[model samples]
Target chain A: MKLRALAHSRTGDKGNTSNISVIAFDPANYERLRREVTAERVKTYFAGIVKGDVVRYELPKVSALNFVMTETLGGGVTRSLALDMHGKSLSSALLDLDIPEGEE
Target chain B: MKTIRIGSGAGYSGDRIEPAVELAEKGEIDYLVFECLAERTIALAQQAKMKNPNAGFDPLLEPRMRAVLATCKAKGIKIVTNMGAANPLAGARKTAEIAKSLGLTGLKIAAVGGDDVIEAIRETPWPLVESGGSTTDLGNRIVSANAYVGTASLVEALASGADVVITGRAADPALFMAPLIHEFGWAMDDWDKLGKGTVVGHMLECAGQVTGGYFADPGVKDVENLARLGFPIGEVSEDGTLIVTKVPGSGGKVTAQTAKEQLLYELHDPKNYFQPDVVADFSEVEIEEIGPDRVRVTGGTGHPKTATLKVSVGYVDSYIGEGQISYAGPGAVARGKLALEIVKERLALMQVKTTELRFDLIGVDALHGPRLSAASEPYEVRARVTGRTDTLAEAVRIGNEVETLYTNGPAGGGGAFKSAREIVAVQSVLLPRDKVAGTVQIVEA
Candidate 1:
């Protein structure tokens, strides 16, 4: 079967740009979210593997901070094959970290 | 160089014509897309299900849809659509029935479900409607509850040999994007490529909107045969850029302004239009209507969403009826306004509330009433208010009191009133990516 038709799903690495519209219930949570999620960590972890710029966006309306990673997915969209990669592991990646509050 | 064609019809709020198909055949364009899904439409589909468990609202009713499907089948064209409202299985069965009726038996049909997490409202604890200043808990009151499942399922169904794939409720762009992924064989974790396809899907999701349905160009009126509108198609390459246009000779103009409007349909920021793929920047974009029926769109950044769930809810008319009132006189407009205002004050005193209220002042709002030979000097004002709330007694009571407005109004125009039945509410919960537990069914024919 073609990779596109495969049931396995992998929703990842929006290049170096990630639209993380996050929020926090309180300043403590905000600090926790900020401490836990940082551009440097994302950049350091995926810096070698992914290409492009990683930027962070913070909103007052959002209790959390957002990240926008640009041009990180293997020279933009044309050469992607991540659909075949099992996305089941994301549950673990997300479970460990806090997502704070999210908007849209 | 192939393209996919699709559209929306039936129970939707716009013209349900098949202008998309007509243009594709005329221009030999590959794909067509139609997008029409609102909170209200799913309600109609639910009501349809009440009468016939198997029958409900589907978009195939638009004249062009039938014409396009028939013509495409005859000419060996592959078509994809999301006409399925509530019961995709039933919808696909009906599509097959139509194909057989047309003697297009080679047609393959498939339905994608299990995206509905509505039943999980009890198991999962999602934020409520007020979380985003909108209601989120669409309990049993829900008229429809289909997840915005991605388009890969449709691709799977198509791969199963479906000449036409129908879906219940997948994200609009997913339908268009998955086809490209299937054709290209793009791999998982390829977020950039997926984003590219997503951008293409977003471009063609609304057929005319991308074309000229809402363009601002002043010189685009000369295209002939506009009565039949043309459908849109996106030629997406591996790199996340594409050319958006429709079938030639199709009604509507494709210009930069049109692209901006559609781009902003769900865009929050000019440079930060984030989807699953590229964090697209509207500011970083350039548009050139290089030739007829073609507009090349470029410059989109990529990003991911922080929140996993958005809320959607619906309503079902408990009871429905039509009633009208007319007014006449030189002071018709002034009096009508006063009458409605008075009715509102009275209803407030009576504690009457409803889900929706709309009033249309017909004769006065018409075009050049003074220029036409038709002179209905009678200052008649028609006010129609319809809504579905928790109770009908208060609604009827309010309706009765409003009728008395004609006697006491300053304009002295007589008033008429009637009460329709109330409708029920269907509520569901929106969950983040982790909580969805249903399994999808993909049958290959």
Candidate 2:
């Protein structure tokens, strides 16, 4: 199952860095999100677009995982020649991440 | 239970004006805060100021004030905004003039200054946070440098009995935080309260975003009546607790999902979301939907602020040339690819110099590259060619190549559009908090 089945995401950019937060649709899916969505996997998933390190911060109370990826936007919004300057669509792109189905 | 109801009027500089007017007339709020001014907005405003001294503020400032001022004044709802952009004094003066013209008397408009620190930045060498270079390297290219100021000056403006407060480059959340501080008498050192207030500000800063404007995903995360989406209003008590809601009978639903998505918008480290007032922590924030279109938010705390403040430095980066032409019917994808190839070869043959270039199919691979795009091809696609160049002449050539496709290269290519503009890039640097001062000047009508 895709991550979209269990969670939703939003992307925010500052300079060259982009932070994307993936929140579970149901509170019960929080543990699976934490276990499956690792920073290493996220960095590899956005290999071409993101050029720097990825840091993951967990917000258990909100059942969300925040991934901060550096050098994500071509440069920054102002300098980047990309069509989506703010990388706003990246959040939707991240929702396409595949999450293995677990026992219900 | 002394509580103040604050309405978030406008989210960004170009946000809708009617939503704000709705808040002013019907929201029943004490304060209406407009959190305008993005990272690059002030830098662009600076360029505007260079062209004309009196025209650096938000262009919609006049229209927005004209729309809501009389009603806000009648209801005794004070207005706060960073629409001052690059010139708060000019903004304040203009607001005073508007108020008087509207026959509203005894209104005090305060302009908060000291956010502009280009001269102070030039006096010393400050290291750039993004790119590993110093401010000295930017030299003459530096157009504007403004620090993310805290709630102090804004609070001061409110405390002085100002009816409207305007600023240029303040921290977005601080606009909402200032009223909380002034009304509740929350000390500047009260980190926990400031943190909780910051959460409210962050939630409300985006206006319609918290109310379901950006959360609509059609069938999956469906939001109703987005076209008439209402802005948010925060009901706050003296103890820093807040209930986020919208005016009754307004468009857009304020469910837990919408509030949750907004809570993480533009936030990196939930535990250390830095602001001028404090380092707010939202990791433990609880979002519970107490009633229809109402969410109770609590459990946000904060740590002491850092010694230095983040300054956004804007400079002339380069010129960008973008062109798009749509192709439809059968074999549109193939034709679009051919057009890109033709433009690529044409630019090379013409010896056009560009630092970066991209060929994208708008409906398909424009957003995410081809790697992530769907395998199946669409019946119609818009081909876009964009390039960044040092010179405007070189930049213009990129779009010219794409426009040439209408006649020279591809078949059925229509809606050819092109634009060439200079890019003003923004970077960050840290300066000692003491180096930048905050000042408030009041203008009365």
Candidate 3:
């Protein structure tokens, strides 16, 4: 199952770092997200765009996983030549990542 | 325990004023915060201030104040804003003048400043937060440097009997956190309480984001009345428990999902979310949908704050030149590609001194490149070329090359538009807390 099947995401940028949050639609799938949506997987997913490391922070209360990607965004918003300098569209792209469905 | 109600008026400089008016009139709030300054906004304002002595504040300040000042004054609801972009004194003076014209009496507006620490920063050799480059490297290109001050000065201003507080470059969450401190008398050193308050403030800082304004999708998320999306209001208690909601009759809803999305918006680390007052820890925070349009946020912790404050340093980075031309009907992708190729060749021939450039087909590969997009040709495409150059002449040439494509290449290319703009980029550096001092003075009309 795609990450979008169980979650919605939003992207924010500071300097060249892009922070994307993926929140589970249902808390039952939080464990599935925690298991499959690893930083390594996310780094591989955005292999070409993100130049540096990716770190994931977990929030079980909100059932959300925040992926902070360093050296992304083509540089910061004001300096970047990319069409979406802030990387706001990156969240939707991350939602396309596939994960195994968990039994309820 | 007593609780104070606070409303978020304007989220950004261009945010809608109608919702703010609704928040002031019907929200029954004690404080209304307007967060208008972006990272690079003040740098641009600094340029404007250089041109005109009294023109560095938010452009819509008067209009927004005109729309809400009367109701806010009548309801005894104080306002705190960072709309004083590059000039808080001028912003305070303008607010005072606006109040007098509106026949408002006893309206005390205060401006808190001393956040501009360019001179102080120049004395020290500090490395920037992102690039780790020395500050002296930028030299004459540096426009402004503002340290993100905390809520202490703002709290002092509120206590000094001011009805409105205008600030230049205080941290965003500090605006919301000040009211909680002022009303609850929460100790500045109380990390837990400050952390909880920061959570509420961060959630409301974006105004409509927490209230389902930006959470909508056509079918997947499905938020209603997003067109007239209502701003957020928080009922915060002395213990730092908060319930985020909106005006009852207003548009937009506050659900747990919305709260969760906002909770992590721009959040780098949940455990070490740094603010000037405290390094808040939202890792253990919890959100519960207590009622319709009411989400309860609690359980935020905090650690000791760093001795240094983060300063936003703005410099003249480059000039951005852009051009967009659309191609429709059959073979639009090929025409768009051809248009891009022509611009590339022209730019190389002209020897435009550009550091970087992008060629995007908007309908197809603007964002994802060709990797994610379909291999089949697109029926409609908009060819966009953006280049970054040091000189305006070089930048203009890049855009001019794209505009020339209408006649030179690519059949059916229409709606050719071009623009060249100076890019003011910003980076962060740490400055000792003692180097920057904040002062608050009430200006009366």
Candidate 4:
């Protein structure tokens, strides 16, 4: 079963934030979805997912890493709770990753 | 293995330090909470303030917190605490300073205030919740007060940025609940969900009390190796069901029955287990054993907050500075009482009037408290007495002459006079309608 990983990022002067999702089959391969997929992995990861800049914050004290995966989650501005195809695209990409199982 | 953690919530004294920490090393735990503020701490801190405003128990957190913080930080575990009494900002800063001193930066430090309005009583009117309590009748006797802030602050601290949240006054359940909220991102107004969260919080508030530290089933095997006992944890779900369990292969035992025993501990009524927001019906909170270590609990409710936030205030206060000349060789009790009588006569002759006069031998029934009352052995006793006076002159008269009993009264053990001076400080407590600020303006060292 696939779970949605929502990406949140800091944007603009006030540090406005955004979220995008990607399908994750397992937590292990989540690292490969982007170059340095971190609170800051958004800029590289969101290249095709969105058309904007991303700001990242590594707030480890809270054990959370935040990002600005802009244009990614915001393209569907007219609808609230809207699911953009960008996240769906990432999910589709993730759903196809071939698994080599040692089955540990 | 599923984890069960437990530790004393507020055995908040330096004396109770070793035992509380040793419970963990003797066992397994996902988390630990220490409740370090109680009426006695409030009283003690209040008295300390009179002598020197800031010269009080901040250091007390050192012994207990050091052991826990060092271990938890090293192991990447977490702690929720209210040892932040008097000044939490100071405590958090102190923690950060220690972290920096040890090259442990990025240690999330958060402080929750704005709930601690010491001056609230004089301004806003608190809508009466019950009739017998008019809140008005309480005149100056109110000293070293605090509001019951809930889990929201801890949740926010965990949300925004904090490896550790040092709070002033919050319900014990809040500490545990805040972590769950941070983990699940549970919304605040979700009463049913919050109810579920609170039930989990309630189960683990008392440390060892839940995990056989206070009570034991005679049938169970060795409870020794108590040095590292497992803490209790409630694996709660959104619907308010939880398993009260400890770490697998731990020092304590957990069963639906043992969990039930803990549920009854320190609580007045099972059906009416109360918190700030919920009149939690323990009857509603059901428990089941899913397996060896998991005792599941369910069915609880939460109400909207009556106050936006809670207020806790601490200030300088006075207490009966009492001491005794222990005359325990022989004829101790009788002579002690006689000496007390002489002090009374002397105070009366000297025109001394006080609010109260207490005379009782330490080993006798006059001494009452949670633990020491359990000591049944009789020993040489002091006729420890306290006389309150408005003026130090009058107070000094009683405090100064307490030693005269040695020469005049029939002495068994030699008597020595001790000081009886108390300091009283008043704090005006108020609940503000704002969340505490999480922004820390960094200072360049």
The lDDT leader among the candidates is 2
> Model 1, range A15-89, lDDT digits (tens) per residue?
122232333423245555566567776565444433555565443322334445554432222122122112213
Ranked by DockQ from best down, the candidates are 3, 2, 1, 4
For model 4, the DockQ equals 0.01
Q: Which parts of model 2 are misplaced by more than 4 Å?
A: none
Deviation from native of the Cα of residue B12 in model 3, angstroms: 0.9
**Better DockQ candidate (1, 2):** 2
True contacts kept of 3: 0.82
What value does the TM-score of chain B take for model 2? 0.99
What tens-digit string does per-residue lDDT give for candidate 2 at A1-104?
89998988888888888889899999999999999999999988888888999999998988999999898899898899888989989999898999888645
lDDT of 4 by residue, B274-386 (tens): 45555454445555668876777666666555544434333233334344677675566676677778877876787766765666565653422112233444557766656
Model 1 spans > 4 angstroms off: A1-104, B1-14, B57-65, B129-140, B215-228, B270-283, B304-311, B315-329, B345-389, B400-430, B434-445
Assess each prediction's global lDDT (C-alpha) against the native: 0.51, 0.92, 0.91, 0.51
iRMS values for every prediction: 20.5, 1.0, 0.9, 27.8
Query: How does residue B73 of candidate 4 score in lDDT?
Result: 68
CAPRI accuracy category, model 2: high
- Across residues B1-445, which tens digit of lDDT does each residue of candidate 1 receive? 4434333222133653556546546545444444555434555676788789887647553344456667766666566666666666777676666666667656665666655555554455455442232233434455555555665577676667666666656666676776677777766456556656666776677666556553322342233344555556666666656777665655666755455445544333444554422344444454556777677776654445434543344444243222335567676766765666666676668666654444434454321122221444445665444333446665575566556766765555554767656444333345575643323343333
- Name the better of 1 and 2 by lDDT: 2
Better of 2 and 3 by lDDT: 2
Predicted structure 1, TM vs. truth: 0.65
Taking chain A by itself, what TM-score does each prediction score? Answer: 0.52, 0.96, 0.95, 0.39
Look at candidate 2 and tell me the lDDT of residue B44: 96
